[model samples]
Target: MGDLLGVAVLGAGHMGADHIRRLGHVVSGARVAAVADPDVERAKEAVAGLSGVSVHTDPSAALDAPGVAAVLVASPGPAHEEALLACFARGLPVLCEKPMVPDSAGALRVVEAEARLGRRLAQIGFMRRYDAGYRRLKALLDGGSLGRPLILHCTHRNVSSPGHFTSAMLINSSVSHEIDAARWLLGQELTAVRVLRPRSSSGAPEGLVDPQFVLFETERGALVDVEVFVNCGFGYQVRCEAVGEAGSARIGDEHTMVVTTGGRAAQEVAQDYLVRFADAYDREVQAWVDATRRGRVTGPGVWDGYAASVVAEAGVRSLETGHRVAVDLAPRPDAG
Candidate 1:
């Protein structure tokens, strides 16, 4: 194993910059060797105080840069397909931010390439899998404490995204995490999808899409529900609950001890996804870097990415048709 894994991060925007900062200051067994962004100032800002890291105005430069053995791809959703293919062709392991790719086909290309490589060279950035609460939840489910999960309930709310976000954005950006988490937690693949749009909230501007609901069912008959409310004035939040015949497990609010009064009630919520899953992200990157050095990736592999994309696309379709959409997954040769 290499003494140190050289990490390059693509995109210097919001999420990308945060990844650069964490990889530089927080993650061990790896160091940020390069950062890429179209905006020179953003690139510079991303690496401003990080010592020994080079900045590039072009993503290709960082991708092609020497000594970069692995990459954390935080680029725009549409840019992921090509950027990830480049990394795969170079045989560099990648930890990519999710919804994998914008569409199923684009995501499948990366999945097929990794399958062709016959190794796990890609890890999807689904930090919830590493969350302490979710980890405990999964352990309980896996140990049969929750025998045969029958239903799952999940909710996600973001304080806001830039105003450019639209109604369709709910599926792609917010609810997709629930899609992946439901699959991971239940150990099942979604086989059907449904989307419901209840009453619109007044907090959302006219024509400013927000407050959408999504429902899905896995092949194992596990039903899942997700509620996404972007303009709800709440901090970034996520909740998961799994019910089974024997027992149930759930991810409770981080502020479970909230105090309420007769006239006022309030509970703390993370300001954004970063703070909500900060520890998960740190541990995820550290684990990926350490595994990359050993030529392996142990969590949220390419399959997870592809599956998330598939579910997201299906959710979009369901939203359009207002019907329950059936899902079909290609059999994985390696899935036992």
Candidate 2:
């Protein structure tokens, strides 16, 4: 316990609880020092087995809890801005889940806030960068083995969305991962976006955009396309294929488990993001903990988070207007 990095986790819902589990059981060198959620019982339940842990209904209290050396923000998107500001004011190193803030303007505020501090304290949770397959893909792209990459074919699907999922979420929430991945993989900024909505799947909720095809134009003249279908009703899958001038590489198929029986063969697909990206999340949190203990911040920083918000906002606009929308981003702060 004395050697462990004590982390205060904000929000005890799905992502938060999973992180707490990792900190307590899976990840080494970290301890759940405190947890906060609007539902006090949920927070308590998340840390039930941990020793010397505090649970609170208000995130501020958890931030102020004794022995807290850092923070992890897994709160709802709408609550992220305030939680992040609090972390910055306290100088707590943070690993915040994506969207950073749901709005581009709010995300920029975060970027600027960290800039004002003259150092990075928050690491936005774009976990794909830590995934084994993604790391390899990044290396392949960086090694120049694939030559000058020209197009990225990406797919994001889900069994189904929650009842409260919105059409805008298809771009902002589901495709935001791809937005960051494309930027990281291509090592360039996305300049514009266009979205095409197809006929809704019968399985999708009424008025919800189930399957949307998105096209992005990168600054370096590369193109990226995403087929985001949140109501596939089959499995949750994320795949990417990068085509360069000389060759192409693909990933996200490593999760398959094959079974052969009754004169048939089948491949099992993950039904949840948690199941599919489990190892990535573990590595992401572990990296954050390792860096925080060394008195530094690492991984995707505030700028990347802000860029994703800007691009996603542009995608949402394209979805609405049925026209290509340019990503108009504010100047990056000097801290970047």
Candidate 3:
């Protein structure tokens, strides 16, 4: 490995573009060596001011580009499996964005493939695990200070939904973060899921379900629930409160600067996730780069990604059928 990690980033979309900037400027010991997007122009734009960076429309071509020592799969969920398998074939470390693969079956394939290799290479992008607040919560639970968490109340809200957003996406894409967080925080696998749909918001697009209530049952008998509202017409907010036998703790209060004016005081709200979780994202990538440089893998592994997919699939089924759905996961392989 060189002194600096050379990464080939796939997909120059919103998340991909931000990651490009992060690898270039924010994170140390790494550089953007290559970038790939179906739109060649976008790929070029993502790497515009970077020296010696290559841009390609084909993802595999970028992976094979010179100086590409590692890979960052920031493409849409559907494209993750192929990119991941390619990285495995090349024996390169990778940081793949969430959902790993959107379907449980495909996600399982990725898991099994890595297990077959008998080592870990892919780290799923569950940046919440790296967040300061979430990390402290995890520490509290792990240290037994929480005294057996009983329930977790989570809320996820976005100012608006993208045009291509769908009802199922509310569970799979939006709440998937919560799905993984609940698992990581509690250190338990979700056993069942149920989703309840409330009336659509008037501000929401026609034929879209803006707000959803998802319930999850853990293997250890803890309960987790998330209220997801993608078209709240306000700001992005993610909050979690874990209730345990001893006490309860909450995070994501957004205790930013408060202004007192006109006989009122109000705190600032972040309009997007990039602003809200900026430090978390930076820490996540830095950790990945540091671990990869040391010839090791850390953070959420392929199994966690697969489990999130299985639970999310169950959540989507619950959403569609309006009934509780059981989650069934494949046995863990010994190697990965």
Pick the lDDT winner.
Answer: 3
Candidate 3's clash total is: 0
Which residue runs does candidate 2 get wrong by more than 4 Å? none
All candidates' TM-scores? 0.93, 0.99, 0.98
Where model 1 places Cα greater than 4 Å from the true spot, the runs are 256-267, 333-336
TM-score, cand. 2: 0.99
> Least lDDT summed over 10 consecutive residues: which range in candidate 2?
249-258
The C-alpha lDDT values of all candidates are: 0.83, 0.94, 0.94
Superposition error at 115 for model 3 (Å): 0.7
lDDT of candidate 3 over 141-259, digit per residue (tens): 99998799999999999999999999999999999999999999999999999999999899889998779999999999999999999999989999999999999999999587899
Q: How well is each residue in 1-336 modelled by candidate 1, as lDDT tens digits?
A: 246687889998989988888887898888888888888898888888877677887777897776788889998999999988888888888999987798888888888877787777788988888999999999899999778889888888878767778787799778878888888888888899888888888888677656888889878777998888988786787888888999877785667346689988877777778888889998888888888877777888778888888888888888888888887676764631
RMSD to true structure for each model, in Å: 2.5, 0.8, 1.2
Q: Order the candidates by lDDT, highest first — what do you get?
A: 3, 2, 1
lDDT of 1: 0.83
In candidate 2, what are the lDDT values of residues 176-272, reduced to their tens digit? 9999999999999999999998999999999998899999999999999999999999999999999999999999888378999999999999999
- Candidate 3's TM-score: 0.98
Error of 3 at 253 (Å): 0.5
